[model samples]
Target: MTVLVAISLTTGILSGIWGWVAVSLGLLSWAGFLGCTTYFASPKDGIRGLGLSIVTNMSGVFWAMVIIHLSSLFSVEILGYVVTALVSFFMCVQAKKTWLNYIPGTFIGSCATFAANGDWQLVIPSLIVGALFGYTMKASGLWLHQKLNQPNSKLAAAEAE
Candidate 1:
């Protein structure tokens, strides 16, 4: 819901800047349909984004395969929504954080890039990197969660500021 949208928008914007079109789409749609969802995506949320990203990244490739067959108009929209739902559920479980959710989108995009060149072998390393990215996102989420949740710390001060 709110968490997914927020995460999506944040991640989408970042991904767009980073050149991750698939993930950017997920985030944008979430933002368009759900307002509160983005709150969950901010660094302040927790490990929610990390968990969501794992599914999103993995599923990105799965869904993109769908787009190739069906009309991009229909399949892209459907897959975007599917991504939102999956990521939303994970966010609820993780307390709503969205740092790691960027993986799948980037993964899918990477797949597209490599697949275009017939370099399927690169996916393996990308996967490893994605997992490591997920781990880092989780750890950072925990740390940021603690700091942001604290009542009167300098880190909290920075957050407030």
Candidate 2:
């Protein structure tokens, strides 16, 4: 089979498994899926992508927590918006660092945290797991493609003849 086909099958199967595991563990599968997407979308690939995904995503969670805490300290509701604005500025500025350069990952991570009602305990692990899924999917897909195209394989036999 073609590499694209192999990757597609691998992604579909793993995504199903991921969804099942997330639901079974009482974790948000969607959050994990976001993390996986973040990993794939990262500028880097392999281990670097995984690290960047986790770091940027967790940074988002941290900033969201700050927004929540600081917002609660004020009596005025508008102050929450102000805090968000300020925190957002810092989030962008943080891109100057190499590890935290994935701006979209941070945004996605923060969005997931907020969606989970700031449940970092659950969200953090889910995101990490999702990033792992992304890595596994890519690795497995390439492996499958290589195996199918190997010299002794049927496809290779046909091509050789």
Q: For this target, which candidate reaches the highest lDDT against the unseen true structure?
A: 2
lDDT digits (tens) for residues 88-112 of candidate 1:
4543343233434454343443344
Q: Would you list the clashing residue pairs of candidate 2?
A: none
TM-score of 1: 0.30
Cand. 1 Cα-lDDT:
0.40
Tens-digit lDDT string for candidate 2 (1-161): 99889888899999999999899988889999999999889999889999999999999999989998999999999999999999999999999999999999999999999999989999999999998998888779989999888787776779889
Q: Give candidate 1 regions above 4 Å deviation.
A: 1-45, 69-121, 124-128, 134-161
Give the candidate number with the greatest TM-score: 2
Residue 1 of model 2 has an lDDT of 90
TM-scores of the candidates are 0.30, 0.91
